[model samples]
Target: MGVCFSTEIKDKSSFHTGVDTDGNDHSTNSSKVSSVPPTPRSEGEILQSLNLKSFSFSDLKTSTRNFRPDSVLGEGGFGSVFKGWIDEQSFAATKPGTGMVIAVKKLNQESFQGHREWLAEVNYLGQFSHPNLVQLIGYCLEDEQRLLVYEFMPRGSLENHLFRRGSYFQPLSWSLRLKAALGAAKGLAFLHSAKTKVIYRDFKTSNVLLDSNYNAKLSDFGLAKDGPIGDKSHVSTRVMGTYGYTAPEYLATGHLTSKSDVYSFGVVLLEMISGQRAIDKNRQFGKHSLVEWAKPYMAHKRKVLRVIDSRLEGQYTLEAAHAVANISYRCLSIEPRFRPSMAEVVKELEKLQEPKETRPRRHSSHGTRTRRLSSGGLAAADDAGLGAYPRPQASLPSK
Candidate 1:
């Protein structure tokens, strides 16, 4: 399950609108178009503008097999995501494993903040179409029931691949990790681009969903906020995000910025490199907080092995590992201004994807042979450099 914090939406006023419920022009002045389009004011108008299918409660209930427990894909604070099938063309309910597969997130009625978050997801995802961002198929808002339908992510989340230990959850290969990281970074870069300019307040591993080919797509826009407008530097809001992933300045002053998302991305990148949770209380005193524990190792060239995942022993190259560590270290900088923009981060990650010649193994003082490398420069390490470090047993509870 994933976690997120909630804050009250200050202004609930409606905005300008033009679209109709069915997304058709019922207006008599269809020929005349305004140079400036009207902003979406009400929920219905916003939903109308996107041209998303308006699904009824009965329609979704049929699509999700009456919301059976067996059909569930995952659960979070907002609701349970159930696996379902729907018609590819008509968007109607279909038998399981047939037609197009979809994930139906049925909002928990008891959650006071769920409705606002649901709308936020619809608002952002409905309008924005990006390969790295999860696709919003449609939505359901019949009476009090609110549900969001999204394209099915067969491989699940980056969180499970990094932390979960089981046959179903395999540790992602080094190359795959880099691929996922780059894909996620591209997603963030798209959101942070001048046209989008949205701050993804919550950017943990769990929100990074994977498709069959292991391509990463960012999901859950509940905490996403519009970037500071005009001369404003940051959007002042209540501190809301997973504890370990939230940026320090945002946590202290409640000023949210795109740099805040960069910090969270660094935390996720660290999690991928170390195969550890961001906030693992079960670890030893000095190792509880992943960022704090790994900072020393990340900065030190030789000591970098102490933080790299043992499971990824021979999978990554030394130079590539160090480069990724440096990226994370810079992104995790205390000063938000010091953090590199997502676009810059994307460029650095893209460089790592380039093919590199393999270098011969070298032996350390401890006599353990360096691990073999397939690409990305020199070989990694064995038990020589990586000291006996205990893996964290517990993870932060999902909200």
Candidate 2:
């Protein structure tokens, strides 16, 4: 596991000054394009450096049926994502579903903030490839238009399946939820375990997309940053992420490490268990923060069951829930030092996949109960690495 520090440092000026009280960032469009000098390489050179496919705007337009509204898959601050089609071999435009399906994300030309994010997505996804990570097929930058094309994730974002309410939504079963969690962990583990570790600063349910077979893939590299190198323990950067999922330490101080991603993973795991948003304004005042509200219950064996999603009442085995909750608790330790690395997390979760008869021996924790948790639980590891972590002083955002 990575090291951590809890010393209270002087607060820095707000890096997200352009962000509104509601957490919406307005800086993307405020700055002029020419204000910031271009890098040494030209735009074309930059794309070439990544060895990425640069598609003509005309090609993408035809693929998306001329950007018809009916083809839209999802829309956000960046722009709308359209369901499109292209030839599998030559990448030519094709009739919808008659050839390879693609998701074309067109950026809103007016939003300057999205340009940097768009380039970051292209550069990173273009350079890295993993089964658990979303695949960027190509990009189009023509005139005032900026866009990205990716392999279509037929099932869409995990956020929709986890929180969106409607008849179209079918609650994910226990096995499926575990599979998604494990896949996402592997994605993060791969990034953190890379030669030059990459910190996925933004880790949330919405960033996890699903394929037709229910396989999970991590998407969106807009806020990802390179980890600290040499002797440096952490990297200092401007705060950026969704309201509820940001780590308390990272939120208080701009210092970031791999543990920050672990903290975010814990929040998403909590969401999977309780079927609740990290921060929901609709919830009562004290109950608005899922992590805060769920913590008390998670500490107790009987009460922990209360936090499980009501939809999954009879679906999962009692032992599996206990194991998952234990992992979440460790990942969410207030002190980063106590949190296990993504690799360790993968091992613990894999144990849950084994049949009951072949499972590891049960172990006792803090005299709470004798729970069988993958040979030995993370609770023991925390005992060896625990450190003090000051509680965050910032009031939780209602959004």
Candidate 3:
């Protein structure tokens, strides 16, 4: 389910009252108009000031072919995504397969998300422009209708690659997985380090959209919020995010920080490594909880291999596998402060792409013998160092 917020305009005529959101009447008084107009603050004013293209219900209907069932790309709690076509330059309605493809998300009027969440999505996506982030083209807000239009992503979402079953789905290779991880990490890092600092409260495989070449972009910014600034430790917000992906601290205390997003990324990383959903009830009794069940194996040098996905068929090297699990382990630290920053995580992921011959190895500080790396980057199980794994200074306090 989506978060609920009230911000809809009840009367369309109230928007064109010639009064800015600040209650300053700009309309002419006795045939005399003001020389300068006030800045826009309301949804209508903000949309006009942004110069964002506004589509009428009729225009979108023509573009989406009246929301045909076959055009549906996917559906979620928010609403259904439909495939549509638009003129390349003008963004006008075009015949199917004749122009640039677009994805139209028609909000479910009965869904938990209302105008507030919808406006948040537009406000964020309309302003931010990054290669790792999905592009928002325009929006339609005719009467009660709320629709978002975006550039078409051909390959769909990372969730389909990681969890979807059947002949139509293919398991992501180690190289592709690493690529997706790196791309997603870059996107999150961008958000956290932006001038205004955005916290992607929702980070999961499904929000990671894939292009034709397997490039990943972050989508769905409805749950995103401005992060804390100077002198502020965290932002207090109502607990909202997907189950299993939310950070423990954020879930418990409603105090959100960038580290909260790091924890969510860790969950996604774990999913990538183990080929399991964050929460699955279909697994064996004790193993249903991916994070809880994988923690022990992740900490055990000899048993770490057991947590890896069987579908991979030993495609990855021993050292690389341990390194990934180590990263995941650090990210999943119970203490939020113990988790590495997104920038640090990105650097570590990037290092994994180095040639095996040039990869560095460290000896255990406890004097445990180090294993020599094979040509395939495999190391002896006994040589693994669980002691080298970083841990929090003390046990975390409960909510």
Using TM-score, give the best candidate's number. 1
lDDT of 1 by residue, 354-383 (tens): 454543343243456545433222112111
Give the alpha-carbon lDDT of every model.
0.71, 0.69, 0.68
- Give residue 305's lDDT in candidate 3 (0 to 100): 79
TM-scores, all candidates, are 0.80, 0.79, 0.77
Q: List the candidates ranked by TM-score, beginning with the highest.
A: 1, 2, 3
Number of the candidate with higher lDDT, 1 or 2: 1
Q: Candidate 3 — worst ten consecutive residues by lDDT sum?
A: 7-16
Model 2 lDDT tens row, 1-399: 000111111111101122333444344333321111122221223456575678999999999899987776555556667778999888999987789988888886765555776766777677888999988888998888888888877565566566645443346656678888999999999999957488888788777877766678988876677788889999876566767888889877767899999999999988988888888878999998999988887866677887888666555666778779888988889999999999999999887775656644432222333422231222232222111111121222222
Candidate 1 lDDT at 380 equals: 22
Candidate 3 on 217-303: residue-level lDDT in tens?
A: 998776677887779999876555656777888867778899999999999999998889888778899977689989888966658
Residue 73, candidate 1: alpha-carbon lDDT: 58
